[model samples]
Target: MTTTATAAPGAHLPEHLDFLWRSPEPEKAYDVVIVGGGGHGLATAHYLARNHGITNVAVLEKGWLAGGNMARNTTLIRSNYLWDESAGIYEHALKLWEGLEEDLGYPILFSQRGVLNLAHTEQDVRDSVRRVEANKLNGIDAEWLGPDEVAKVCPIVNVSSDIRYPVQGATYQPRAGIAKHDYVAWGFARRADEAGIDLIQHCEVTGFHVGGRDGDSVTTVRTTRGDIACGTLALCAAGHSSTLLDQLGIAAPLQSHPLQALVSELLEPVHPTIVMSNAVHVYVSQAHKGELVMGAGVDSYVGYGQRGAFHVIERQMAAAVELFPVFARAHLLRSWAGVVDVTPDASPIVGRTPYDNVFLNCGWGTGGFKATPGLGWAFADTVAHGRPHPLIAPFGLDRFVTGALVDEHGAAAVAH
Candidate 1:
């Protein structure tokens, strides 16, 4: 909660430090109130201050900063989605990620080594080719790699046909890679704070006072801290999106499930680019600190617990060893899970609600971390202009009712 002021050149000040202060207490009213202080909400607040000149904004969090799903994700980022709508939004995020460090003046350990989605069956190859073609058509970089090319790109992967899900080919995106998830969240939080955005942690929203000329709009948000009035309220509560919306008598088409991930004991780099296999149901990537970060599908049932069943991790490890036999010997360092709010079509819901000046950005599912900056940029525009950005307009809640969902389950493989 404190930043040390760095010493000026040859001046008397703390070196490599900045001024420190406690987060301000919430005011009676803010121009805007954002629920959840995760990367998306923090980014949205930053953009509202930087782009829209909305400095009187407050971001409320139920826990300490970035203590929710933002801290629980495996930081894999990519934008090689199959659909144009999905591609557009994620690609915008990718571009923002490419320059995030410089923009935030914070090192997020951004690395664009590459990412490869392996193909195990003939149908997998066909789908990979189709997706690659679509990605190229949309101006997103993607290529289909044969077994030999896939092996060359990631030598540690077992490409032999002897395995259960042998590598037949793969879809490769050179721009895809991982970043420091915590750093990204903190960087945005720090910048948002500098922009005069109130980051009120431990301030859980309890309810809202709905009143307007039409008698259906949120005039004030009742929180653990106290009720605060706002002209507009944006919800970015991720897994708890439904819980928060229910307080307003609004129901979102979101199903919450636990998605787990684990990191192996640190070792010398053996894995190269990020490797994934929908057929085997595991994805592996090495973190900046040398731990093998791995993840797979979510649990079948719905749950609010932030931890998942042990068998799910066991199965994922079994699949990981099947693909990379070397990983069988690696000891698990730690494991955790994040509750994700998934939509039926595997796409995000970003748009206005039934009530005036009440916006919702949820149902990002497993791929929310990768879309942080883009969501912030677009959602900020949405809240500022009172309409969604064109990139996210198609992902509105109406898509579910109108049956225009953009299904990307295949592209968002391994629960991100």
Candidate 2:
């Protein structure tokens, strides 16, 4: 693998880019075939070679690498949740983010500047405090901060009593922060490429040919490139998982919704730590380039469009100005939307389907970016052993059937 100088924080992309991965043609067959070339798929391919010694792999993307939801996330990373299962997987991902740069031999710009999930009402305070305690019990760093402390951490926030949603308190995780999303994806892609895993782009999987004694295994993956036989298949496609599942004649309990986010023009550093207000429906973090990256809840309707309703963006900007009064003057630079596959429980589905040799890792909703590394590790293990990894056993498709959902709607710090 080639080593390059770490880009300075918030620096613009270099005029010339390093060749990260190869653009290879699809092979006739492979030991394992993964659909999706976003962070999860790339990370899974990297670990499949580094951990399990499985190199005969192919990751197929409908578009360019990381061009889907991976490119359109707010880039907030945290693991403080109300439930044990939620805490486990997310905290694991936080640990991986801490050392991802060193492990990948690449610069990911992972900044652990801390995160504050704000509480506005009495009930919000109670929930935030309970989540903090739950995080401590699980050996994760967490704390409860009052309005004054919240101001000390982020002075620009409007913590006064006159606001519609006055600040009561917040759950603070000192280890939680943000990273350069594209850099993280490139780091994983480069390593997987170095390991000889095929990162094929512009190759959409149209359908699958299933054949086995019980007719429950995928024999070939029909893609735009051509049909390729596979020993096993894994679906890591985020928003389009349901569409792909439909091709296999499998009913998935997943709904796709548009999640919108926007950034302000570059300016001097004004925001420090990450601040998220679920009650008001706004989350804000200043990027390395000095832009205020902000996002809110998903659109109510189900749609595959990569853009959101104007009313949603208007509401998000209104919430931002109310919380951070200073942002009222900040000019809107650009905005975008990413389709997310949400489940009823607001948790990811990461396990087996009816097909014996096919696996799934979807239904992440708005929290997919944070779970990339952790999910990649567990999903790769699950695909290698042909069983649900213990870390992801509770997230199988049978959960909906058996009433074993890992519900995280309230604790997720965002509306699902």
Which lDDT tens digits does candidate 2 get at residues 1-416? 11111212333323344466677888899999999999999999999998999999999887777888888998989988778988888989999998899999999899998999999888888888888888899999999999999999989989999889999988899999999999999999999999999998877788889899989899999988999999999999988888888888888789998899999999799898999988788899999999999898888998887776778889889999999988888999999888889999898999899999999999999988998899999999999999998888989988998998888875645532
Model 1: ten consecutive residues of lowest lDDT: 1-10
Residue-level error in angstroms, candidate 1, position 313: 0.9
- Report the number of the highest-lDDT candidate: 2
Q: After superposition, how far is residue 361 of candidate 1 from its true place, in Å?
A: 0.2
Model-by-model lDDT, in order? 0.86, 0.87
Residue 88, model 2, lDDT: 88
State model 2's lDDT: 0.87
Candidate 1 residue-wise lDDT at 333: 94
lDDT of 1 by residue, 239-281 (tens): 8888887778887788888899999999998888899889888
TM-score for predicted model 1 compared with the true structure = 0.94
